[model samples]
Target: MIFFIILGAVFAAVFLLTLFFSMPAFQKNAPASSLGKLSFFDTKGKKHHPNPTFVERIVLPIFRKFLSIFRKFLPRNLVESVSKRLELAGIQDNVKVDVFLGIKFFMPFVFLLALFFISIFFKVPTTLKMILILLVPVSYIFPDYYLKSKTAKRQEGIRKSLPNALDLLTISVEAGLGFDMALYKVAENIKGTLGEEFKRVIKEMEIGLSRKEALRNLTKRTDVTDLNTFILSIIQADIFGISIGKVLRIQAGEMRIKRRQAAEEKGMKAPVKLVFPTILFLLPALMIIVVGPAILSIMDILKVMGQ
Candidate 1:
């Protein structure tokens, strides 16, 4: 139709115009005239001369505005919850939970939209129509289950690594470095859950918080049983002016023993856990393979005798 043709032409024209206007911005290398200097156009169509880094000119503003809009819609309470969760997970720096919550909010809409399209395509049964609706919201939230599992695993790793990190800290402290410097040194050398917590603790100390207060905050954020005990030990040692090295060495040995005990418990449970699967699945298959031919031969003999 003439109307369709005109609409297509208009769309093509708009697309070309957009591509033309945007091409200069997408160029990998700046124009020869602007070599060693940065240039950008302002929103008002005026050429404002300013030095801009490649990321500042190309990426940061776009990402910043996107995050700003996203944050505007995210609930503060949800952000707080995410922040707390991240803190417990030992990720403390350069992340905003509002961004995460915004993604969470958007994910449900996207999943629902996908479900709507799938329901239309498949002509899903009326009896199961409710499942499709439920699946949309459920799938959206499914990622949180994965996130929680990862966080738990990371926390466990941190808990297991804490004693070693603490011993190193105690050594560094006893070797003439201040507690804060020792924390930094340990954080630098170690790479795990406890290392991340120590890194944040060091950052806090650098910002003027006392060593004890920072360690206490770390304990609160982690909520790990072993970490709590370790912090208490540190606090007590500080209060009594006892040598930290002795306390740390004892704690580390105890933690290693606990790790060994946990491993032994898991080994003990493995056989019991495997028994059900072996009985239910493998045993039946084995019995069928062993007795099947014998049963067939017995039936054949009986048939021959009757004949």
Candidate 2:
């Protein structure tokens, strides 16, 4: 009976997979949406479009399937909110909102199913069961939390790296490089979230986006205050007939000053941040070490007096 059941399961799984793959949608030339995303540029100044990988083919499809089932039940506002969050997280290219919602919708069932199987097989304690049950909600929330963290980190990276990148751009411009070439050089040299964003901007400019539009798009994508300030400054310089080098030079100095001030602010806040940990964990341990023996000795004396 076990052998037959295992064989039937395997056959059923294979049949489903085969049917899904054999569908004309999957067999036909991959959709433009699934292919040809802007990744980088080559020597000939052409945008390199990347093909979808394994995650897109397998994992995303599974989530997309779940999304389709529950699409009608989801609110339009909630979907738009999720889309904005994904865009901010800088994963708009790799993961669609539908696939993300599918994951969110499916995760609770996954957690409950795991718990069900574990309870069936193992002798589970009540506390553990409660924790596992709580985790179902957490699992549903984890993706959104992860995206928020990712967006925060990306913006922080841009903030930290902006000063140095600006300095390099200023130097390149001062040395007779055009703004586009200088920007491209800086993007190629400094690698990080900032560099990748600059590269994307450069690519955008190459593909018929005006410099202002490209810079504005960059500001939109990053949402970094300092970056937005720099973009606005550049745009204004273009409008008022200011030299690019002087603008770059001024922005570089300001960026460096702002970064220094930010560092000093964090340094000033460090003591305040440490105070809570010192009180909560270290102070109790220290009090036990210092006053514990004294309390013990006083107790002994009291016992002697009583005797």
Candidate 3:
């Protein structure tokens, strides 16, 4: 009976969320068109939109109306923060801040409601009950955590890749290409978060942003220390009429040193990271395995003496 209730709650939630996700598909209640857009290209460069899916046609309009009731409660600053984080995570193209915020706002309550139903229908143990209570907050912030993790990983990749890109840029410049041409070369060859960033910078500059302004925007988007420092050096080099190749070479060396230092730091911390697991999990299990038979034999001898 408890299983049935929990399963029903899950299915109901999934059905509602499906409509909610498909809300992007509906026109004018237009997030509906997002998922159910059936957007496709006919050969010869033409596009077509199929009619909305049944869920979008029927349930999602009602679901959007239901979703709006909660949107009022997401504060302005919170929404702005979410938007900024989404951009940082590079997911702003795919996810609307409003939709993400709404999901974050409602998920915890939905979970608590389901758990409430389960508890009332079934006698949940105290330990499990406490764990469920703890998990509610985790469930609420999980999206935020995911975005943060993505942004951090992107920054780390940028940090590690900067030196190689700078070396390429420096080599290209030394090989007689202009700085802009060298940057294009690096973008052509480099791949990863840093390469993507270089591509964005090139596009920004092509679209009439001055080199200084575009590089500044690159720093704003990434916030990687070495990249920012390299940008700063380039900007100053431009201001003072220094050679960009020289700046690139210098920055490449410094970034390489920083990357090596970061690797060494991680190596230094590995033992510290391992210490807790070694003591708490491994030592206890090993001690029990090694001493168990001896202790059992001692207990048997003591029992025989008592007899």
Candidate 4:
């Protein structure tokens, strides 16, 4: 027994040493270069380019090409649907959507690989195996759900902040700044969803788009009814040469009233929303605290009588 125990200990030590020595080599063999070579052109008809590293020149392009072909086999409609959903979720930036789709496309494979390793390591049962198989697809789509929820929350925040933003814009405009300049000033001062939207509007104007067009685009991007109405009012006022400050003041007042009503509605719903949790979670605990001592006393009395 002692001989066998010594042999097992030696085997274990050797195995650990081998694993430790092999890990760094395995990591070194893994690919590191993922991006393409960067190239630039000079003014005097000269081009500058970085020579591609071995992995970049040989391996990465092959992997990208293989991915391109693999992507062709995927359903076009499904990709389009995902893109549209992402657009609605306020991931309107093309580059971000591309990255998101790339991640989505790769995530299921990674999840399946993880599941494969886990099953191999743990010898999970068949029922759990089926559940993990389902989770692979779920993990792939989870980011989309998260992004949608974020977008909704952001939109709600913007809605809540709208009246204050409009009031500030009105004050700025009334203080002799042009509408575009007022928007720029408001974007600089504020720091939330409203500010972000206004910043985008300012950027569009800076890039030579008209104020009306930028505001209209902002409405379309946000899809908020109040903003849409505000934009329409501004356009109409612009067409008729009305005072912009007066228009903004009126709009701000209406928005403030709407916000107040929304708050009241939420307050009214709070009791109804609390009812289920109060009954399910808190009421049971309250009953236990109130009746526990009495129940214990009665049980003790019954025990004494039996004795």
Cα lDDT over the full model 1:
0.64
Off-target runs (Cα >4 Å) in candidate 3 are: 1-5, 12-74, 112-135, 285-307
Candidate 4, residue 81: lDDT: 67
> Candidate 2: lDDT over CA atoms?
0.73
Instruction: Note each model's CA RMSD in angstroms.
Output: 11.6, 8.0, 6.5, 11.0
Clashes of 4: 0
TM-score of each: 0.65, 0.72, 0.73, 0.70
lDDT order of candidates, best first? 2, 3, 4, 1
Error of 4 at 188 (Å): 1.5
Better of 1 and 3 by lDDT: 3
Expressed as tens digits, the lDDT of each residue in 142-165 for candidate 3 is 767766877898788877778889
Candidate 1 vs 4: which has more TM-score? 4
Against the reference, the lDDT scores of all candidates come to 0.64, 0.73, 0.71, 0.67
- Which pairs, if any, clash in model 4? none
Instruction: Write candidate 2's Cα lDDT for 211-254 as tens digits.
Output: 99999988877788999999999999999999999999999999
Worst 10 residues of 1 by lDDT: 30-39
Give the higher-lDDT candidate: 3 or 4: 3
> Per-residue error at 248 for model 2, in Å?
1.6
